[model samples]
Target chain A: MQFWPWYLGGVALTTVAVGHWLLMNRMMAVSGRVTALVNRVRFGPDKAPALSGKELEDALLAATLAAFGDEALKAPPTAPEPAPEPAPSARPQLTLTKPQGPGMHALFFFGLAIGGLLSVLLAGGLEVSPSLRGARFEALFDGPGRYAVLLLGGLCVGFGTRMTGGCTSGHGLCGVSRFQPASLLATAAFFGTGIVTSFAVALLLA
Target chain B: MADPPCPHMKSCEMYEIFTFSETLAVWKTRYCQSDYSRCERYQRALKGQPVPVNLLPNGHLLEK
Candidate 1:
């Protein structure tokens, strides 16, 4: 089966990203969703005076009303644009549009996983193998040891992402596109460390 | 590095209101401090639309 072109994935990513911002006015940070899930489980809602269920929906409605005016309550704008810099004299202020809770994050997480599965299925590449997928992976961690390595690697990734305040999708895609300096720096650090780690792992396994 | 504060904070009316008025400080936290991209005034300005002086960040009209 022919593999999908790399740019198709790029196009999909771009569509999701632009749509995320346009629809939600929020940054599309994949790891942030994980953070939200963990925080929800560990500490409860991020905001004080927590609103849940219908109240949460109402609050969102209120925010939407505030964002788009009275008429917007009827029909919300589809393609929201980033607010521009003020001219000579104007200040920044915003209505607090809270991030979606863990439930939404779980949905997003599942969506990502299911989307990948669907794409693979469509490509006719669905196959089950007990051994780790790559020769390098099998060499590095044979049998059940691969699971341990995967778990440990996942922990490291989670920790690193929380420490950095974002993962590749956040810093690399959204931040870099916005020309945010910190995002640029974070993206560089991520790529730099990733390259070094891959080479080190290869050497060790070899 | 920390996220940069809104560039228009110095001359913005909402900045003054949010700074001096204790109750409105939440606006500062949500938009002025971190992400001004979602600000109504900022967005309006970006689109070359007229932003009224009494317009609040949430797009609500501020009552005098």
Candidate 2:
């Protein structure tokens, strides 16, 4: 079968990872900026930069942004802005607090891992492929080995996706389109690792 | 302090916000894939966080 889908998926995922990383830098400036935003809103517009409606929401999103490990937010903000009546009290805290430890970051990674394992089993073991498994990948292994390689490859995808922050869909699709430098770096790491890993596996199996 | 883990549930951080970002950082995701059908599925999936997106070889669906 044509290995095109895998190839497309590979390139696309990389592009997104790269793009999103750059996007993060854009979204979260130095933590001080966050302080300035909160200060203006809480104290008064006259006290500092006025918080526009959009600015407020964007600031809230950043504060609320839990995706991609950001350790800075782990500790509670010194002076958090009061939440709107409609919003819950914890709203500001959850988004802005970064996971302090690697353990916290593991959740995102584990999520991807579960997703990867699911995809691998769905397409690999169950043999639920839209297309036949390509010969280039298959030639490296017989029946049992093929399944092993495929599953392992899927795990790698998940692990790598976690380490870099954002999976193929996250960085490759969403990020690359947005022109994020972080995503760009992540995409490169993904491709380089994937190619090297795939080569090592192919050689070992051969 | 964060919520304690319940007996039945694993220690999962509920979808809640802790702090706020000082900057107005906007993250846009671009999806490229053969299935235009799943575009909506993906769009819906990526509510505000980064998600996996499959793009075509040269389908330019994203720009600054």
The TM-scores of all predictions, comma-separated, are: 0.59, 0.31
lDDT (0-100) at residue A146 of candidate 2? 70
Off by over 4 Å in 1: A46-94, A128-132, A204-206, B1-64
List candidate 2 segments past 4 Å from native.
Answer: A1-139, A196-206, B1-64
The whole-model lDDT of each prediction reads 0.68, 0.41
Q: By DockQ, who's the top model here?
A: 1
Docking class of 2: incorrect
The DockQ figures for the candidates are 0.07, 0.03
- Scanning candidate 1 chain A in windows of ten residues, the lowest lDDT window is A73-82
What TM value does the first chain of each candidate achieve? 0.70, 0.36
Q: If you assessed candidate 1 against the hidden native complex, which CAPRI class would it receive?
A: incorrect
lDDT of 1 by residue, A1-206 (tens): 44678999899999999998898777899987776676577656654333334453355445434654555423223323534546534533333334576778878888898988888888888776545466988766677787788788889987888777789899899989989787899989989998998899778888
lDDT, residue A102, candidate 2 = 34
